[model samples]
Target: PPPPPPPPPPPPPPPPICQDVGYKVYRLVPKPSVQDKGGDTLELELPSPRSSILDTLTNMLCATCKPLDTPIECLIEDALYKADGEIYVLGRISEDDLIPFRSHKINLDGWADLHLQDFLNLGFHDKNKKDNLIVVY
Candidate 1:
């Protein structure tokens, strides 16, 4: 019997879309606390209160990694409803009152009114290895 024919050559790799530009991305994370337990409230200390915006997204996997498709304004207990913790939602005015560090977002979907817990719920835990917001506690 005769031998079989050889297989075709492999295809070339896809062209590059663009160069990998290094962007200074920032993710809002709850200030690392050695201990947090004073009722059902979680306090996040942001470096700069006025410079950053906080908003909530629906089914978003990561807060810092991507832009929100639809962001809803936070009423009094928006974070409480969206959060997966025992945090008692307070009027954002209170949270904003005591932040001790600067936090920033990419400003997609009107980043003007994002909430603290909302940002955290989106997966800014830094455990997510995306190039977006990488926060390590």
Candidate 2:
């Protein structure tokens, strides 16, 4: 008898297009205060290069004042609220805690070390507090 036709090859796996998309995790540490609680961890998907994560974070933290352009100061201070109704600046993560976000552990050598200040510049013009801020990313 003639040999049966071989079964059709399995459909090609879906293109790995979405695999490139990834997320970044950030810790929002509010300035220390007697009436304030600890910080909050936020996970944000990598936005397009045209958009800024700082803007996204500002929008999430503050709904009232959304600046159209990058301001000269830390917006967190304007957004964060204390039990006493006072505004405070946000703290930056230590260099040790500042690491690049990777979906996998492979080829870590290629990833560069990223410092908190490198991404966000916290300007403390006054000795009493941090006033100006800029998002470098």
Highest lDDT against the true fold, candidate: 1
lDDT of 2 by residue, 1-137 (tens): 99999999999988766342455456554433343233764443332332333444444333223333423334234222222122222333332332321111111111123343443432222234343222222
Error of 2 at 55 (Å): 20
- Model 2 spans with C-alpha error above 4 angstroms: 17-24, 30-135
lDDT of each: 0.36, 0.32
Lowest-scoring 10 consecutive residues by lDDT in candidate 1?
Answer: 81-90
Candidate 2, overall lDDT?
0.32
Candidate 1 has an lDDT of: 0.36
Report model 1's TM-score to 2 decimal places.
0.20
Q: Count the backbone clashes (under 3 Å) in each candidate.
A: 15, 2
